[model samples]
Target chain A: MALNTQPNLFEPGKRYFRAFSPGDDFYEALIETHRDLSDEQSEMVNARLILLLANHIGDIAVLREAMSIARAGVVAKD
Target chain B: MLSTYQYPKFEYVRPPEIAEGRDGHYPVVIVGAGPVGLCTAIDLARQGRQVLLLDNDDTVSIGSRGVCYAKRTLEVLDRLGCGEEMVQKGVSWNVGRTFFREDEVFNFNLCPEPDHHRPGMINLQQYYLEDYLVQRARKLPNLEMRFRNNVIAVTPGEKQASLRVETPDGAYTLTTDWLVVADGARSPIRTMLGLDIEGKVFMDRFLIADVVMKADFPTERWFWFDPPFHPNQSVLLHRQADNVFRIDFQLGWQADPEQEKKPENVIPRIQAMIGDDREFELEWVSVYTFQCRRMNRFNHGRVLFVGDSAHQVSPFGARGANSGIQDADNLVWKLALVMDGKAPATLLDTYGDERGFAADENIMNSTRSTDFITPKSRTSRTFRNAVLGLAEHHPFARALVNSGRLSVPSFLVDSRLNTADDAVFAGNMVPGAPMDDAPIESVGGEPWLLQVLGDRFQLLHYVADAADLDAASVAALQSLAEGPIPVEPIVVAARGRAPAGLRTLIDAKGRIRERYDLQPGTTYLARPDQHVAARWRALDPARVRAAVARATCNA
Candidate 1:
């Protein structure tokens, strides 16, 4: 099966890591989403982003799944 | 005549030493045979998972590290089924008094909480408490407590953890499904993981003197702030259950640490707390700096941090070890469920969220307590004395008395903060929640919940039928269990019909009040670790489904 075609896994990366990262196109979109969250909520999201990224880098198995989730999520959006 | 309470003999069948490849692997390997690590192993083993417990110490216990255990920690131990022995051997004292100078004294009674199951505090030497935990850990069939083995390093991954152990026999590598670091505050595993601990390192050091003294001290804790005998110093005198006493003196930054064991200096400091009028012998005297700090993140890959590794508060509240134990209690079941394919991944995140919040709260409390008693400047010292002075005459100081005396009440990790409401019970700890005393009969001795009004750890049997839950929500709860809960985060089942299907858990007295807090006619799904996963007004099928889903998915 294609990487993104796995079952039960949700689409990933609809959310950005921070307020603005260099060369990121979703800065405006994330800013709009930021309006929905309080300061604590935004910080919670940031913390979750760090953990998810750590999971991807820490373990190969997690990285494969994360890649799949990212591919499938972006594919679905496109 | 023999001392009836003798330590048991260990003569177990030894396994042949085999090479690493052929042996079937364990899911997690815990280093340190301390109470926190041992109990964490037991909690996992009870869930039918395999664990390898490693400790560098040849035998159990090192020193009397933490003695003042709060009610919340006792409740967690009770869930682990060791509370009976803990309570029997330990001392329970609930009143705390602050002595200003020599004359003015104010006391705060920590006993009168609204709950009936537990009072505020218990006292046992740290060694005795860890001894009971090590005994319980040894009994688990899936648990292997490897003594004299120290954790050299930990490498965390998505599905498993790699550990290096330095043993007298030799060095060995271990692999497991998860890594839980319970090694003390200077945790080697934590440092390797690069977890940042952020907080002010208080320059204020203290003298912790555990001595056997005969004096006129009350059966409570007494603190002296800026007293004449030791002018511009702080004194913490706790009367432990027996003749033993814990005396801590706030030392200035310039004080020499070597003075504690100098033989010339130890006795004079001991005489300061208990006056020279009495005879006493010093057991252990250590002068150290009490730094207040906590890690920015509690998890590094498959590794989960609990107890001191995750956070360390000042000894002011006796909260550091107790809160870390709560972290262990909260994380184990969720990890078990996910590892066992019972719950979702989001549940693991709640471990960090809930526990980090707890550590943050405890840090705030410990810092406040430290500031109030051990002021930094002349003006701050005057303010602290003023507040403590009013404790007797004013109602506000009385409230300050409860601040450090009580623990942070246990509540669900994701539960929204309760805004001010007249009829609401406000705390992370919910009311009439299912407790850890799962009756012996259910799930073959695994931890289960006894509903406030329901029978012991009984499953929902059939909510209109056995599989009434919708697909979307069922999947959510299954994936996000923060810890071990009876309802399976999906559907905690029972052996029998239950007739009414849902029943209440009755205490020894058979009355229905929440051990933490109480609310009538409420159905709460308690985490296997015994914090409420989610709660509702009625046992409405849809609401139950929604709550389970909310708990599981963060929806």
Candidate 2:
């Protein structure tokens, strides 16, 4: 097996404050989905949303890479 | 069927006037008589150190505070002479199920194999554990338990600590060569000495309600994340002894503690979890917020901290009391050696190093579990929900569902006391890991490996034939066994082979060899707490002596 030494894709990028970005619009819409629902229903919406995104990203290798990237950055504050 | 909670009554004892006008200095003074404090006293007493145990309260803990006792904690308790009674009385559990909504997401079996003496976890009231420890402490002549005696002040010096004791009669002052602080989370001794515990205080609350009823729930741990009845919060259930069950409801940060603890409000929560058709009586109700923090240093001058005073973790992992018991276990022998002048004072520092590592491991796990249970942000909640939903159908995602990673014994990988392996070795039994227990047959009868290791430095010689060991190796073993604080040498012979001389233990059934991955002439030097100090493929006297020296901090 070849060693894939990509400069840890998990490293946190510099924060960019956005005022007119679509990311803000998506964040508001995400909160709107759980506006009046119970916590369980909100959690279900989240689960379904994750499934849809995961399905869109299809490849197993990509999913594993993404998970590792998500987990890598923060050193436990010991 | 319902039952009422009964509290034990203890007589208040008056202390002698050592502080009044006498020049008396005690060897060791332990403050607080909780399970950790009492166990520390018992362990130190077993090592022939006279211990003075003082408790402000007259009885054991008020409620069923810590009910889940891990197997490693039980092993330490067994070494202190209370194992059999605790194992007999406590409810043994090995299975845990985690549920998402009404569906079971994942289940784990902690210990499936059955040659071990203790179970993975036991559900007994904290009062019962304290009762066992106090009873065991009473029988030791070297240990003196003083009730209604509170330590109001503490001043730590280079060689000794000056302590002011408060009693009903009045106040008195005394000096001690060494002081132990096991005074729970809000340790006054820790505060008086000006020590700060640094870590995260999770903004989450939990309601603990112990109910008594004759229900048929299997002896297992059940946890639910966002259950049908308890809508957005989590809930936990465990069956204790005497028809009592412990139920904890995860109330968010904004919940009112006082109003939630009221019987009127608490009864409905219990009724919702366990149906109202099940008749039960509320034994105790408590509301607490989770905090994951610890002192920067456990060893402070002449005073040492153990249990909650040293470190505190969220209750999700049951690391709070179990790790406290382990702290006492790790400290007693080192403290005893330091007090006896057999080892240098630097040996006491390893207690802080090793247990600090453990505390960090516990804090990391507890913090992760708390965040998973009570996600602080929208993105975190989305991922947590994703993991939970995937966990139901895919085996890969099941490992992601964290309903409190259960407590396990910490492996001291970076301990300075351990001698690094320079030779080729097999098996997971490394130098710093606790020795795994296996069944062995001695001259008397079959005894567990842990039972034989006991509370002393041990040289475990795994030999196929006595003829294979060199004369110098044999002499080194003899010298170790004949030292002042002798290290017992047990020659574990291969299956059915009897090595006539020296203490021989038969590896009947070959379980010992398999677990330890023992070669023909492997040697392992273990600390008094049964933690492996050093091991080698072949014995070398110079290396063995150096390892022992380093382990005792004489180097």
Candidate 3:
């Protein structure tokens, strides 16, 4: 129910050219999700994809933690 | 272009002012002979005001524009004596089906309840609507229709509004006590006054093809989102009268409007949707980009703006013409009172207050429908697709699918003219809401409730028994009937013989009582346009007088 702030994503018996291959795979898939999209479209896809994933996650605590962490250093306009 | 229908050209005769080489003044001068202007002229003239209607053109609308007429608009037209003709000539429809890709997402019945006189909506060509209105206007002796007289300039003044009009003979100057500007969206009068409409112009285009074909499609509105034929756009299919079907294909901002309008490009699109074998002729084809905008104030001193001249909305909801008709309905009564000096000129301000509020509501709904149909950003489209995808099975998601909200009369709940309810009510017939129509039995025969409710301020008092019609109640009714701004009192009885002297309508089935949420002594004060001004559980003479005063802006 709560966010796993610690190391969470894992795959048994997996190796990569560098560490955090799971994170790299996620990054690569995210990039591929926005492959042919323009910047505006990619932003739209990111927003909707987040909503879809958030609905799937279905955890307020995890969403709050993820959102806070994502927004940690970004200054929002008034 | 339509084979089934031919446009009738009205003969323009030289006006008396031009023939006699003299200027003239009138009580009410309406610019533009469109549906709104014609309706306004008819409404004012029927109330014994002299009205001169000027139009640049001599015929009805060019094409099948504004095909859907809502129930509220039909009711307004009924008051102008044009409702029956329009309903008979138009295609009545209430059901709407929405499709997502190839699958049917949801269908809705606009008027699920029975016994209402008019349907949820009717699809009639704009030309027919204007023609019917013109015919009705002609029957009114006080209304003068000057077909070729075009208003070139308007000068609004303290006492009157002056207009420079051009006709076949020559240009002439005329003045009117009140000027009604119903000249449409591209109002030259609005431009001459240096006024501007403030709102959002959607970056989208739609091609309207009125295809004449003998097809057996049900009389229902069918809307498709991202269908296979269109492959990423929306399409709306509606049945108009005379074998004409209005097909609107949503073309995105990047689409070439001029290229898409060509018959060669349009024919294939229609064929792709309806199939190749069906024989059909393209009646009319036009591309349009819409905006949801309105003037800051509809009333500018002596000059009043009505219909498209005051506000405009996207065509998706059919709000543009319907709301304009309502605007005329709302303005005429107020203007009559102000002109007769029964109500202060300030009463006219509520026209702006109420209809301005309505304009915003319409603009908001229209803008939302436009956004859903044409998503500006990719994420919005993603959500739109998600909603459409989920809507096929899930009921909640169907609610999220917004093809078009469809035009409904705006409830002027916050209008200053509406007296706040002092008693508990259990129905939708609240103050500032349009009175719901119900079937009732009169002395002559059975007629709809609204048919008997005369075109004036009305006191609808409910009486369950003869004892309820007390001396105090009769006195109150008599006083209101004889007031400065007279209110006609109509008695609605649950079960009874006609009252001795009162005008009584028999609520045989108690539908009127149920719809109005009437107890034995329930009373309602309705405005001239049939909007509820106030209601009370029990009739109080002083309170009714105060409410009437407030409704007329005298308080």
* Weakest ten-residue segment in model 2 chain B by summed lDDT: B494-503
Write candidate 3's Cα lDDT for B1-555 as tens digits: 545677778889988888889888998899999999999999999999999999999999998888999999999988888899999999999999999889899888878878899999999999899988988988999889998888998889999999999988889999999999999999999999999888878888899999999888899999999899998999999999999999999998888999999999999999999989998999999999988889999998899999999999999789999999999999999999899998999998999999999998788777667767887656567657766765665555566667787888887888989899877888678888888899887775748887765468888889886435777778777777886878888788976653457777888677888888998889999888988999998878788888889998899
Better of 2 and 3 by DockQ: 2
Candidate 2 versus the native: TM-score? 0.87
Worst lDDT run of 10 residues, candidate 3 chain B, spans: B390-399
lDDT of 2 by residue, A1-78 (tens): 222333222215522111112322333355556666776777788779878987986877877776664454233432
Best model per DockQ = 2
lDDT of 2 at A77: 36
Classify candidate 1 by CAPRI docking class: incorrect
Give interface RMSD (Å), model 2. Answer: 14.5
Q: For candidate 1, what is the DockQ?
A: 0.01
Tell me the DockQ of each model, to 2 decimals: 0.01, 0.04, 0.03
Candidate 2, residues B1-555: lDDT per residue as tens digits?
A: 234445677787767674355534699999999989999999999888888999999999988899999989888998898988888889999999999889999888878766676789998999999988888988999899888889998878888999998889887787999999999999998888889998888888899999988888899999999999899899999999888899999999899999999999999888887887998898888999978999999998799999999899999889999999999999998998888888988888999999999999888777767877887766667766776776665554565667776788887868999999888777667888877788778876748788877577888888876545556656767777765567777778764433335677877668778878888778888888978899888766567778888788976
Cα DockQ of the candidate 3 complex: 0.03
Q: What is the TM-score of chain A in candidate 3?
A: 0.70
Residue B280 Cα positional deviation in candidate 1, in Å, after optimal superposition: 1.7
In model 2, the runs with Cα more than 4 Å from the true position are A1-78, B1-5, B18-23, B465-476, B496-501
lDDT of 1 by residue, B265-377 (tens): 86787776567779876666777777788888787668888888778888878887788788777788668766766567677877788778778767866776666566554
Chain A only: list TM-scores of all candidates: 0.37, 0.58, 0.70
Best by TM-score: 3
